[model samples]
Target: MAEFFDNYGALLAQGTIDTLVMTIASCIFAYVIGLPLGIWFAVTAPGGLKPNTAVNTVLGWIINIGRSIPFIILLVAIIPFTRLVVGTSLGVPGAVVPLTVAAAPFVARIVEQSLAEVDKDLIEAAHSFGSSNAQIVVKVLLKESLPSLVRGAAITFVNLFGYSAMAGTVGAGGLGDIAIRYGYQRFQGDVMLAAVILCVVLVQVFQSLGDWLARSIDKR
Candidate 1:
C-alpha cells in the first residue's frame, strides 16, 4: 500500500486536479454560450412568448448537428480551432475548448427543457401585470427553473468529466492521460484501477452535491 502511494500518489493527485480544472472550466464556458441560446429556444418555440417558427427551427437544427458529433471525433476535428482559441491544443486550456463546444449544445437542450417546464400560468400572470418579455424571462422563467438548472449543471459536469478523459488521448493532461500512458501502455493494472476509482468518487460527490442543492433551492 505504502509503496503504491509512494510510486503514484503525486501523479494521481496532479491528474485529479487537472481533470477537475478542465471539467469546471468547460462547464462555465458551455453555460456562457448555452444559457442565452436556450432562453432563445424557449422564447421562440411555437407556443412561447415570442414564437418564431423559422428562428426556432434553424437553431434547433444547428444544436442538433452539434450534439450529433461524437466527442472523440470533435476533439480531433477541432484541434486547429482549439489551438487558435487557446494558443495550443495540449493541456487544460486545450481540453476546455472542445469540451465546451461539445457540451454547449447539450446544455442548451437541458435549459430549454427546464424552462419549458415552467408554469404557463405564472407567465400569463406576469404578462397581465404588464411585465416586459425580458422581465418575465429573467424573473419568472429563470428564477422558477433555478433548481432544474442546477441539476442540469451537475449532469453537464459529469458529461464533461468523461469528455476530458478522452481529451487525454491528445495530451490534454488529466487522469485519463495517466491511465493511458502508465496504466494501459505500461500494463499497470493497479494504477488504472486507482484512476477509475478516483473518477467514480468525483462523479458521486458532485452529483450528490448537485441534487442537494437543487432540492434546497426548489420552491415548488
Candidate 2:
C-alpha cells in the first residue's frame, strides 16, 4: 500500500477531486432543472388539484424516455450535444454536460416520489385557508416534503458520483477512468482497489449526511 501510494497518490487524489467536481456540479444543475419539473408533473397529473392530462402525459413520456436510456449509451449518444454545451467532450466540463442531462430526469422522479408522499389532507387544509395554488405548493407541498427532498438529493448526489466515474470511461477524468486504465488494462489491482475504497467512502459520507439532515429538519 505504501508502495502504491508513493507511486500513484497524486493521480488518485486528482481523480477523486475530478469525481467530486463532476458529481456535485451535475447534481446542482440537475436538481435546479428537476425541482420545478417534478412540481409541474405533480401538480398537473391526474387527480392533482390542477390536473392537466396533456401536460402530464407529455412530461411523463419525456422523463421516462430520458430515464430509460442506459447512462453509458446516453454518454455516447449525446456527445454532439455535450460538445455543443461544453466545447469539449473528454474532461470534467464535458462530463458535466452528460451527467447533468442524465441525472435531471432521475432527479425529477425522485422529487416526484418525495412530493407524492406529502399528506393530501395538508394540501386540502391549505386550500381551505384560501391559499393560492402557488401558496399551497410552496408552503404545504414543498415545505412539508423538505426532509424527503433532502434525502432524495443525497441519493441523487451519490448515484451521480458513480455515473461520473463511468464518464471517465470516455476520458472524463475520474477514479473510474483511473481504475479502468491502470487497474484493469494494466493489471494494477492495488490502484483499482484504492479507487474503489474512495468511492465507498464517498457513498458513506453522503448517506450519513443525508440521514442527519433529514432527522434534524423533520418535525414529525
Candidate 3:
C-alpha cells in the first residue's frame, strides 16, 4: 500500500483536483440555466402564477426528453454540440458542456419540486397584496422555499459529481478518468481504490456542509 501510494500519489492528487473542478463548474452552470427554467416552468403551469399552459407544456417536454437520455448516451450524442460550444470534447472545460446539459434538467426538476413545496397560502397572500407575479415568485416563493431548494441543490450537486466521474470515460480528465486510464486500463488496483476513496470523501464533505446549511436556514 505504501509503495502503491508512493508510485501514484501525485496522479491521484491531480485526479482529485480535476474531479473537484469538473463538479463545481458543472454545478454552477446547471443552476445558472436551470433555476430560471424551473421558475418559468412553475409560473407557466396550468393555474400557476402566470398560467401559460402552452409554454409550460412545451418546456416540460423538453426537460423530460433531456432528462430521459442516459448520461453516457447524452455525453456521446452531444459531442458535436460540445465541440461547438467548447471547441473540444475532452478535459475539464469540454466536459463542462455535457455535464451542464445533463445536469440542467435534473436541477430544473428539483427546483420545480422545491418551488412547488412553498405554501399556497403564502402565494395567495402575496397575490392579495397586489404583488406582481414576478415579485411574488422572487420574494415569497423563493424565499420561503430556500431551505428546500438548498437541499435539492445538494442532491443535484452529488448527482453531478457522479456524472463528472462518468465523463472520464470520454477523457474528461477527472478521478473517473484516472480510474479508467490507470486503474482499469493499466490494471492498477491501487489507483482505482484511491480514486474511489477520494470520491467518497468528497461526497461526505458535501453532504455534511449541505446538512449544516439546511439546518442553519431552518427558522422553525
Candidate 4:
C-alpha cells in the first residue's frame, strides 16, 4: 500500500481533481439548460397554468429522447459534436461537452419531478395573490420545492459522476481513466480499488452536503 501510494497516489489525486472538474462543470451547464426546460415542461403540460399541448408534447418527446440514449452511447455518438465544441474528444475538456449533453435531460426530469411534488395549494395561493405565471413559478414552485430540488441535484451529481468515469474510458482524465488504464488494463487491482474508493468518497461527500443544505433550508 505504501509503495502504491508513493508511485500512483499523485496520479490518483490529479485524477480526482479532473473528475470533480468534469462533474461540477457539466452539472452547472446541465442545470442551466435543464432548469428552464423543466419549468417549461411543468407549466405547459396538461393542467399546467399555461397548458399548451403542442409545446409540452414537443418538449416531452425531445427530453424523453435525450434521456433514453445511454450515456456510453452518448459519449461515443457525440464525438464529432464534442470535438467540434471542444476541439478534442479526449481528456477533461472533451468529457465536459458530452457529460453536459448527457446530463441535461436527466436534470430536466429531476427538476420536473421536484416541481411536480410541490403542493397545488401553494400555487393556488400564489394565484390568489394575482401572481403572474413567472412570479408563481419562481417564488412559489421553486421556493417550496427547494429541498426536493437539492436532493434532486444530489442525485444528478451522483449520476453525472458515473458518467464522468465512463468518459474516462475514452481517455477522459479522471479516476475512471486511471482505474481503466492502470487498474483494469494493466491488472493493477490496487489501483482500481483506490480509484473506486475515491469515487465513493466523493459521491458520499457531495450527497451529504446536498442533503444537509436541503434540510437546513427547508421551512416546512
Best model per lDDT: 1
Q: All candidates' TM-scores?
A: 0.98, 0.97, 0.95, 0.96
Off by over 4 Å in 1: none
Q: Candidates 2 and 4: which is better by lDDT? A: 4
lDDT of 1 at 196: 89
lDDT of 2 at 178: 88
Evaluated at residue 105, the lDDT of candidate 4 is 90
Clashes of 3: 0
lDDT of each: 0.93, 0.90, 0.88, 0.90
Best of the candidates, TM-score: 1
Across residues 34-99, which tens digit of lDDT does each residue of candidate 3 receive? Answer: 999999998887767888978999989989998999999998899999999989998788889999
Two-way lDDT contest, 1 vs 3, winner? 1
Full ranking by lDDT: 1, 4, 2, 3
Tell me the tens digit of each residue's lDDT in model 4 across 1-220.
Answer: 6998899889999999999999999999999999999998998978887999999999999999999999899899999999999899888888899899988998888898889888888889899999999999999889899899999999999999988888775687898888888887999898999999999999999999999999999988
lDDT of 1 at 158: 95
lDDT of 1 by residue, 1-220 (tens): 9999999999999999999999999999999999999999999998899999999999999899999999999999999999899999887888899999999999999999999999899999999999999999999999999999999999999999988888787777788888887788999999999998999999999999999999999987
**Pairs with steric clashes in candidate 4:** none
| lDDT measured at residue 98 in model 1 versus the true structure, 0 to 100 | 93
